[model samples]
Target: MPAARESLLDAAYAALMRRPWSAVRMVDVAVSAGVSRQTLYNEFGSKDGLARALVRREADGYLAGVERALGSAAGPRDRLTATAEWTAGAARENVLVRAMLTGCWTERLPAPPLAPVPSCTAVPAQRRADGPLPTPRDFVRMVRDRAVTVLAGPGASPADTAELLRTCELVVRLALSCVAAPPGEGGMAELVRAVLPRHLV
Candidate 1:
């Protein structure tokens, strides 16, 4: 992208973090970015469109982190442990993520006359001008696939490895939903202990 476009995105992101999305006006983003409203519209279409772009940017950041976590030389268990720690840590520290948890800007977006509960799950990767929690399936898939590749190492059959990965996905999803505590050293170890035994056999 052009330098101006990049500046606009950065400014928009900064604005979104400081206040609720409803409070963000396109003009404000333009002013902060040192661009005109017309330029903002040309690049981002509309506020809703800008929201989607923001979501995509954040998602890219997250996927990159996942890849980095998996790329380390650690064993499958350690890799997975580190991935979980980073994920939860990111979620906790991310301003946008905190907005979702605190319900800070729930009504900023246009809603349908009759709509489902405003769970973060409904936000499309491209449609989300706002960042929400990672989907359970997505979170599970990343963890499971990386675990399979690293843990299986050499000589493991692909079929068995796939089975292990799928099993791990299910276990991880349940742990994410049901486990009360945040994932940490002990929590991550417990999650691995629960899934590893079943998949190892």
Candidate 2:
């Protein structure tokens, strides 16, 4: 996370937008980043590692936006609406997001839906070899936590958790589809806005 290393990752992500990950050779990224090939290797280890990092970075940014939008809201309904709008806008605006959607680096396997917690359990301290920590299931857990936060109002109960889960699943799915499909076709924000309030209120 040094400034220089972050600059390199930014360059790599920018390059990936113009070309598929397979075509984004290390030499090209190194040159674009104004860093040496050895440096790239030392930083990310491999192309797959770099690509995964890029994906994780994007995920982190989007989730942060959702958290911010929710925080600014005065109520559950507004928070849900803000979250939907924030997600749609982020999907439409992110070039790296679009590239990851269209590229083959992770094609065979669809990106897992966003979650509130890390996808994987943390490796025990004894299992570490002094590298970056693995991405956790926190993303999914994030989605869950936001829903719970919104639902934690007067008269709220555990019984409503199922509905909140359903709403989050639909919102995330719609945003994913929007990023992957033709522009404006996904209608993710509108879909969420229309569906969430009916269940919440």
Best by TM-score: 1
lDDT score, candidate 2: 0.60
lDDT of each: 0.60, 0.60
lDDT of 2 by residue, 88-130 (tens): 5776687544433334234432232322223231322111212
- Tens-digit lDDT track for model 1 on 119-141? 24332432343434344455566
- Cα-based TM-score, every candidate: 0.68, 0.66
- Which parts of model 2 are misplaced by more than 4 Å? 95-141, 153-155, 174-190, 197-201
